[model samples]
Target: MNMLRPACVLALMTLTACTQTWVDTKYQQSDRFATWVDSTPSPYRLLAGDDISVVLPFNVELNYKGRVAPDGTVAMPFAGNLPAAGQTLAQFGETVNRALAANHMTANAMAMVAVTQTAAHVFVGGEVGKPGELALTPGMSVMQAIITAQGLLDTARTGEIVLIRRSPDGRPMLRTVDVKALTQQGDPAQDIVLQSNDTIFVPKSSIAEVDLWVDQYINKALPFNKNVNYDINGARSF
Candidate 1:
């Protein structure tokens, strides 16, 4: 037991050093992730499931509240289906006007589209007091998300917060942040702004090495394969 203890401590120290090296080279030195933190995102585009209010002055009957369908379209009273997702409010209004013209409903139809309820979302998990999906508000930061999660638990590792986000091009990426610097030292650089579909994971101090420790301790305990596993009855069930 005593010999095993020193091995564990040495392993932890070695892992910590490797993590610090990774944070410096892979994250800090990378320029691709800088855009997400440094640059402000473009205007919020309409998304599926967004509640929109459309007003048409010439055709009052056509004016109604509708939600964007899963296929990125909204059914208008006279215009049929119009693409609402991936467009700003102004762009959506233009689309409605063009649709109205194409249908010969009106020559100079004016449409005003406003997003009554947005569809953006952020996910918080791991050692937070509350871990779940949160509605992504305009200009929400990482710190705000932690607060919304009811703050970190006593066992949380503040310095090892991980932010997982998908780039605009649809590639998944990760960034490491030090919450201690952001909160205690007042470092704005450490507080990254959150985006839609962003996931913030605040790991516990004991599992700060993340997947490595999980693979060592947790994965080994589970007796299962990619194809089969035991059910609740403790029988080998497919």
Candidate 2:
């Protein structure tokens, strides 16, 4: 009996070790991931849909709020037709200044152009506390965006938050952010600068309990002859 007890104990230890090894192997395989920059520069440029405030200190009466037309130009009284698209605020100001000077409207006109309204905005959708479109503001940050969205939902996969941005060449780029790390670990690097037309998506938690209910409903809907397995293991479930 003593020898049998020792053999049983040895077998149990072997089984435990094997189980641990399997778990470790699975974890190692799942660890294949990539890290990205915490903060990135805004890739958005002035487009046809943007609204700008053009101020001419030389003539406040001539100061106007201009919206970029479909053809990417704004109509100004003295400035005539000026191209406002594809230029930054500073660049646009320089252009307007040059135009006014050329037309002899103001010899030394000091103009300040700013983005008063942005028609290009970022959409925050899926599993966030509040899923909606957020308007882009000057000097907006990712942290401010999340806050505007009312923070992450309880089922939000903080590590899997995705930022989708479009490049100048019109190619879409994706960046994964660890929002929990930013909030919990106080990692400023994770607080990225936000741009117009960017989309921030917070995916639902992979550990959602509703998946089991969905699987059950699917099993019920399947025909009896379909040979569907009702067991969780049979469904290859998460």
Candidate 3:
């Protein structure tokens, strides 16, 4: 069996930030998201931040890839802009197929839509074995990402590993996770599902000023409690 993961490239840098709010993993659940581990992924609905690819077998020259716009649409060469968000890849594929036929490009067009990148990613940085942007597959956990990074370094502070996520309004929400206790005490709570654009920075030592470090060093942000509640007939906006 052959497996692949995104390469880890790192640079030692200080984690600086401004005043931030933290949701500790000890007492509460930070976010609510559906997991798609070993399940049919076709049901995964498209979101604004998701990146997709469209392939028109009948018109290969018109093939294109791009991110779903915030307005819930994706612009293609001939298709112009089609409703992409709130629709599954399969559903959107059919939409593209019809658009090609309507445009007289092909009467029997079978277009395929694939996700080149999901809306979220798991970024591991700081004192780790190999820290970089790790792919955030569906149902991926924090522990899994840490292991993929080849486990934490000895100099890494296990007690205060920082999990930085974005609020819906786009503000950074800092959280402290104790990986040491999670592994030593058989605690599952600490191994949270990595959210969209979540950054797990393993500090070499305790962070006296979390806000200052995050504001100064971190760039990517994520949201919490995100859910896609839509039915076959209609779609929901995120």
Candidate 4:
């Protein structure tokens, strides 16, 4: 009948809208996120706790191992403590080479500064096997982060793993990733590069969750805050 035609058309429209929304959400978690991540800069900056191994290939005597001081400097044998916390590996290496050339310590010396240890912080929480702050490594990806957290649990929402990061302007931003799509579908684009202070949160499949727990675990402990909850993970020996 004529009345039935109108009802059928309305139902069809509703279904179409729902399908479009589902597609859009999936695209945001996949292709759209990939585009955004590809455009973001991922340069690694040296931090105070990071250990740098400087090797003067021509002058082995100048070779030394040291940590970047809290004052953003490194103590070399001849160079003393020079500024280093803000520079990248290449930039710091160039600065060291220039210093050697300027002081006439070693002419034609190419200084190489390598990060033997990175003290970069990355937090992993939610339905992971282990949830805690990890020491980040160069070239680490989101998938690797999950692995370092001891992999995911059976209750993990594989499609709802959220990455919390600070934007260029220092504002917090969130990106959802379909981890199953990355692992099962073999989509490398979903595997985004992680930066320091980044947090990966995997919510339960049945519930939508936020990162307040991550803040508690990180902020409520140690030098970050004074309220130390020694029972956060388990009973401690020390």
Candidate 5:
């Protein structure tokens, strides 16, 4: 009888620990999504292949709107072929300003550069609501990307969304993001800033389902935690 008492106490303690852990995990995941509502704006740098519109203020003749050439140069009437590849919009604007000044075309001229369109795009593939290439616009966020992909499919694993990107040296990099947390909890941090040529993959809901299953298992392992045990494990035996 004493041994049964200890077992019962141990079970109760285990149950309490499991309940706390489950609550912590739930809260953590929920908090992550909740914080996304007030997330800071994404600061993604422009890259090659982005289309830009450069206006010289009442100088339509000098204004250039076109795609960044393969070599990263845009041909302006007076500026000739200028380097724009691998340069941010600000840098490109500065380069254009310097070029215009050097060529004596415009002295102390103010150049208004706007990204009318963004050619830098990423691909979203697999078990998503829409699987295809998604064009990334300036100020685009991860949530936007997923939304552009038509949201996740019914079988989409919110936590298994994988972001594949290229490193500075062109090496492939992979990052796993939680889409469920982002959408359900409003966590903006999980919505990482995307880059040109980035790829997002929404694998089937295996991972999330597994996590839920694990949570269920932990609940089942707990003793006297009726609420969690019933909710997670299933109908009670007696």
Candidate 6:
């Protein structure tokens, strides 16, 4: 614990006094994560390796089914290859329709894009064994993500785990969860069910100097894998 003290001091000292004020105003502490999070779900964006089926409403013969290529495209029946990754189903459908109409493949080019499969994931970092992205299985929770990340380090401050998630409006919101309750006290309520694209950041030590660590690790250090491209929020399931 004392070993992490220097890092805490160095991290905190680098910031100006106003930074602390900003943190206070910026990260509101609340158990009601749903309130801060957007109410609606965002459309699923296509990604490399995601399986999808394209249906031509008018030209049924040209319907195609395939996976998004590693280069972020799909090979179609008539339009050849079109970019699929990063675009939502509706957006991708529009792209396909435009391409079909331009080439005069069909008079009515309205198409439907259906997601057959997706590689949903969540990121876990800091004070964990194997900090990286993990596949987001149904009902994945905070405890599960930590365990999948190879579990926590001896220096982990489980009481101050920071969960950053994007709201429906696309704004990033944060929550501090006390997972120590679940790990140490066996309190099931401490386990928070995660969303796809959610990130779980366990702190190294004291919450007294969390601002710097949050800025350093949560903001800059961790890699935000574009899978689901989500910052996670929680809905309880205990």
Best by TM-score: 4
Candidate 2 lDDT over 1-238, as tens digits, reads: 2333344344334432332231233422342322232345643467787888888886887787978988999888788898888887888888888888889888766788878777666667666677667777777777788888898778777875766555555554556678889989998777878876666666656565356445656656656545433565665322
Candidate 3 lDDT tens digits, 122-221: 7787668988777676667778989989998866778877776655565555667789889999787778777656777777644534543565454324
- Global Cα lDDT for candidate 1: 0.74
Badly placed stretches (over 4 Å) of model 6 are: 1-26, 29-35, 38-48, 51-118, 207-238
TM-score of each: 0.58, 0.66, 0.47, 0.68, 0.61, 0.45
Clashes (N, CA, C under 3 Å) per candidate? 0, 0, 12, 0, 6, 3
lDDT of each: 0.74, 0.67, 0.67, 0.71, 0.64, 0.71
Worst 10 residues of 4 by lDDT: 14-23
Taking the tens digit of each residue's C-alpha lDDT, what string does model 5 give over 1-238? 2333344334334433433332233433452222212224444445556778898885567888887776768887677788877676677788888888899888755677778777666677666677666777876666688888787778776675656555455444455678778878988778787765666666655565566667777656646655433545566643
Clashes of 1: 0
TM-score-based ranking: 4, 2, 5, 1, 3, 6
Top lDDT model: 1
lDDT of 5 at 83: 85
What would the per-residue lDDT of candidate 4 be over residues 44-155, giving only the tens digit for each residue? 8899889889998889988989899888888777665578987988898888887777777987768888998887877777678887677888878899999999999877
Which ranges of candidate 1 are over 4 A from the true structure? Answer: 1-39, 55-63, 97-112, 167-171, 206-238
Question: Model 3: how far is 85 from its true place, Å?
Answer: 4.5
